[model samples]
Target: MLDQLIENATVVDGTGAPAYAADVGIRDGRIAALVRRAPGAPADRAPDRAPDRAPGDAPRDRARTYVDGTGLVLAPGFVDPHTHYDAQLFWDPYATPSMQHGVTTVAGGNCGFTLAPLHPERPGDADYTRRMMARVEGMSLVALEEGAPWSWHSFGDYLDALEGRTAVNAGFMVGHCALRRYVMGPDAIGGRPGADQLDAMLRLFHEAMEAGAWGLSTTQSGTHADGDGQPVASRHAGPEELLALSRAVGEHQGTQIEAIVAGCLDRFSDDEIDLLVRMSAAAGRPLNWNVLTIDAAVPERVPRQLAPSERARQAGGRVVALTMPILTPMNMSLGTFCALNLIPGWGDVLGLPVPERIARLRDADVRAQLLRRAGSEEAGVFRRLAHFDRYVIGDTYAPANEGLTGRVVRDIAAERGMEPFACLVDICANDDLRTVLWPMPSDNDPASWELRRETWQHEDVLLGGSDAGAHLDRMCGAPYTTRFLGDCLRRRKLVGLEQAVRMLTDDPARLLGLRERGRIAEGWHADLVLFDPERIDAGSAVLVHDLPGDSPRLDSRAEGVVGVWVNGVRTVREDALTGAVPGTVLRSGRDTETVGTR
Candidate 1:
């Protein structure tokens, strides 16, 4: 007898194969059978044509559970390859909104940030690690302090903590920053690791790999900083240290490395491209990087960024770029840390104490210097934030600014007979630094959308970089999986449902070497999503207080994710959670096989 049977589904199958009508049978947590309609049969006959069931006898079938998958598209569950769910998983096992959107598997500890390898002898070590995550990954400090159990110190212990608690399959990579901190202690932040320290980090990396870590992840991006605003440890690592650590990844089977380079947000120098190539070459594995955002304002940017992947490939190393399939709108303010800090001189003023920062913003010379720097190319990708006309005022603190909410900065500036920058600073200062600003996202333009479609078609690019659990208050990326499918099926239609599902499922599974979980084959794990093709979308974003410590984060509800099953147990039904935790902690070498260039 089958555990479950889904009848009348248009099976996309997550293989980039043509869609077909089928009745899928599940038994013992695997796809037991896929009973397809005979060739040239009418589509309407799929539901009534179960091979073993007789006519007019639906209830007599041996299947214990039957799902009327009529008018639904069933495919393998999404695999999110780039996320920062390391902290969130400890508190929310479902990794919500992601799980809600049919993502049955997630790869966490990205961009060189993870909470593990804490120094047992050092008090406040966990606190320091959590604070780093809070700052660098945009997790709420209160949530980290109140929600997570900080008892575990080793990477394996952390994975053990999540074993049975998660509702979605989870995997993690040993983080470069965590490894450095474990080896170098308090000196990890700014001090370059000596030979002995580097060797210790390599040993720790090996142990973490042995303990089921997927691989190693690190960052060379300037944007990452710790709680005290110092560069994260990975930023201080020299090329030699990074290559040595990457070499450790090849020591284990079924592993892949993740990195966030300066090229993620800016142009990569030849030296930087060489470094990525050498790192991947040393690892004998693919080096997947975070966040390849397309910008219409700069038409050449995407090509320029992708050239590194080409160079890496030509140099006999594999590299893949991760691009989000949705626009990335950010809510930022002067009082908080944000993409604005990536501006050349903005952090100096913005990072100050409230009183001093307010005073400096009102200073003529300082304001001029900051604006001049922001308008320059040295501001890199963040220069767009200076275009105040595109910014909408959201929240206000002072009574005088009550009417300013929902107004554009340029409009306010024009009415006040001042420049946009001056007007913005005045409004924030008067509001006691509580004013909110919504900037036009970089990837919202039509040209970028077309470019995204084209990029998805590229061999070296993968659909990912959702950053699902990070940047809690600033942005919501967890819904990207469904939102992208919505775009494919309901809006743009540039990508077929079959290809989109393949990109989200089998493509990532193949790249990461996760075994038996990305397809709907007879023996594969039954991680599946059933969704209405006409109505699959992540709705408009809203602020929600669903986190621990009453902290707020952005979230969205899925419109058409009807059923999500992990290991044959329905974790989500009717777009809601069933509280069933059937997820596995996917371990490299144990649950995965060695992956190489296809």
Candidate 2:
């Protein structure tokens, strides 16, 4: 007899075969038997895709629990391969917004900026390896300040901090920022690590891998800035230091690498590509890097760039797994940083207090001065890509710009007879800096949206980088899976359902070597999500202040996550929390072994 059975459901087995009606049986946290209906003539009126009825089988009694999933879909549980829950784990164990969706497994430590192994007693600790996640990843400094206790100081100690109990299963990549700070002190922050410091960092990497860290990650994207608007640690490191770290990760068995290389696109010459290829050959293991987004500018032309380091794998480089995000909902506040990535010199304005930012924006001299400082050559590129549309209000003293809630910045600028930048400043100052903005894509076109589906189907591309626990205010990539399903799979049918599910589940799981998770098979961990196929939709994103320091973050509730079980415990039953904490801090290459329910 099965421990539990779901009768009359569509089984879109994680493998991209075909979806069919079937009855699935579960026992001991695994799919015990695929109870197929007999051949032809509707044996017992069950679907033909249901496991073929055994010959001369005894009439069995009902399962311990019965789920009449007549119109539901059951596939492998979703695995979020990229997030920054390193600090958020302590306060919200369940990983909240993510686990509430179908995500059963999470991999944190993307972009190389994680909080762990810090030596706060050291002089450079506050500067080099710091907790201004708000600046880099949009994490709240208040949460980092008031919520986290400086308990552990090594990679292993950080793992220990996550051990015994956690909300959902997670694997971590040893952070580059923490490692550099641990080894090099302030020199690394200013520029590159010295030879001796590089060696120390390598040693630390080895220790972290041995301590069950999944891998290592570093970011070279210009977007990842310090609180003072400088590049983070790994961004400035010379190639030699990065090559050394790659070698260290290669030496450790069960390790991978993730790096963000936005500047690489601008700076890479042929020699640089050759060097990247060399690094890959040295690393041996696959590298997962911050990825390819759906670019609207040139459509699918892709700027003639070779990115996602894994693309270099065929040319004898490291397999930098592409961390693809299907959506880019540009979440921005009305401060100087509103769509700052789009607007050059805007992030600096955002870093200021509201009054100061407003003052700077109101000063025409400052604008003209900064524009002159930008110079013609560099300023041209900024103007082309920066769209004045899609800026909305996220917060305010009260709702001041309620009338202009979703209006584009261009419209506001035109109506107010001001430069787009000046209009943005006025909106921020007049509205108490509460306006938020996002890019509203016109439609899922074949070139962009279709490319997203095709890229995920790419055998080398790794489906991850939701930035789930980070990006508090503006973005909510956590719902990337649901959006992918609702838009690409269901709405447009760009990709089949089974293939899409596998991209979210087995792909990342297999990449991380998660043994028993991400599958619905016998003897596997019971991390499951049951949902209605037709009724599924990712609700729109909204802000909530549920964090330790009352930090506001975008969260989306899953529409069709009917049930979710973690390690045989129904952590989420009927789309609500059962509060059964059956998650563990999964080790690299050993992402199994369920932790006890807390």
Candidate 3:
């Protein structure tokens, strides 16, 4: 008898093929059989009209459990290739909100941030790791300190801690920052490692690979900084050092590379382009960067950003770019260290204590300097927030800001007879700089959406970069899969549902070399999602104090997700987790295949 049978559903199959009516059976955590309906048959009649059934097959009534998937779309579970769920999985084993959106598998430890391989003799290394994560990833410091025990010292031990304890299949890459700090200690930042230190790093990288790390993830993005306001460890490494680590990846099976160069947030320089090609070629594996933002207003940005991928291909290597189809809305505050601090010279004034920061903001010279830096060419991606007038006030704490919530800074400034920048500073100052600011993205024009649809079909691009686990308080990108699907179905209609599912599932799975987990073929793992095609979406973001130590985070619930299963165990029902913990801790060479570079 089948363990479970889902009947009368439209199966998209995660292959970009046309959807068809079918009944699927699961047994022993694998797809046991598929009973496909004849062409043009109605889904409700699929079971009775199923064709090509094998002899001695058990009837639908013989299944131990049955799911009525009437009028719903059944597809392979979504795979998120870029996330920071490393610490969240320790306390919230379900990887909440993600599984609620049909994400059955997640790859974490991106952008050179991981939580393992601590220095054997230095106990303070753990504290440094926590603070760094808090600073760069937007994770809550209180949650990081109280969420999980910092007992493990090696990558293997860290992986072991999560084994059999999660509700979603999770894999992680070894981060360059942790690897550097482990070997070079306090000298890990802003210097070339000596010969002996280099050798130690290579050996540690090998050990991590052996212990099931997905691959190597590093960063050279100028924006990343530790709690001490120093550049991240990976930013200090020269190209030779990076290439040496890339060479180490070539020796491992089922390993790839993930990196974030400075060009990831802007246009690529010729040297950065060549360096990416060399790294991919050195590793003999594909290298995928974090994000590729598309805006039709900037017509040259897409081609310029994708030029490196073409260059890498010509050089006998592969480079893929991750792009989000939906614009994830994020909230920022003046009191915290955020992208605002990355605005070139603005960091010096913004990094001061609340009293000093407010005092500086009140100074005319300081405001001019900050404004000038934000509008300059050096701002890069952070320039998007330069339009102080467009920011909508979110939460306010001072009595002087009454009736100002939900108002734009420009309108308020006009009413108060003040410049928009001065008005913004005044509002935040009234709240002691704790006012929440929601800057509206200017790239939501129709042309931009059209360009995004075209770019979604690009050969060198894939759909991901959710950043779900990090930036918990400011943003919640975990629901992009459902949100994009909803837009495609009901709003945008730019991309077909079949193709979108394929982008969210098979594309990233193939790029990451996940083994038999991205499709609904017979004998493949039965990770699946069933949802209403008419109403699926991610709801609005809301702040919730659910993290450890009662820290707050932005969260959203799904609209039409009905059921989700990981490895044949139902983990979510009706947009809520079912407390099932049957997910596998995916490891390189065991749960994946070696996807070659060329």
TM-score of each prediction: 0.95, 0.86, 0.96
**Cα-based lDDT for every prediction:** 0.85, 0.67, 0.90
| Global CA lDDT computed for model 3 | 0.90
Ranking by TM-score: 3, 1, 2
lDDT for 522 in candidate 2 is 59
By lDDT, highest first, what's the ranking?
Answer: 3, 1, 2
**CA deviation > 4 Å runs, candidate 3:** 39-61
In terms of TM-score, which candidate is strongest? 3
Tens digits of per-residue lDDT for model 3, 133-183? 999998888888999888899999999999999999999999999999999
- Residues 417-505, candidate 1: write the lDDT tens digits: 99888889899999778788888664676777787788788888998988999998888888888988998888888788888899999
- Model 2: per-residue lDDT, tens digit, 259-316? 7666332333455456556666667766665554444443532333344344465655
- TM-score, cand. 2 vs. native: 0.86
Q: Which ten residues in a row have the lowest lDDT in candidate 2?
A: 589-598
Q: Which candidate number would show the highest lDDT if scored against the true structure?
A: 3
Residue pairs with colliding backbones in model 1 are none
The TM-score obtained by model 1 is 0.95
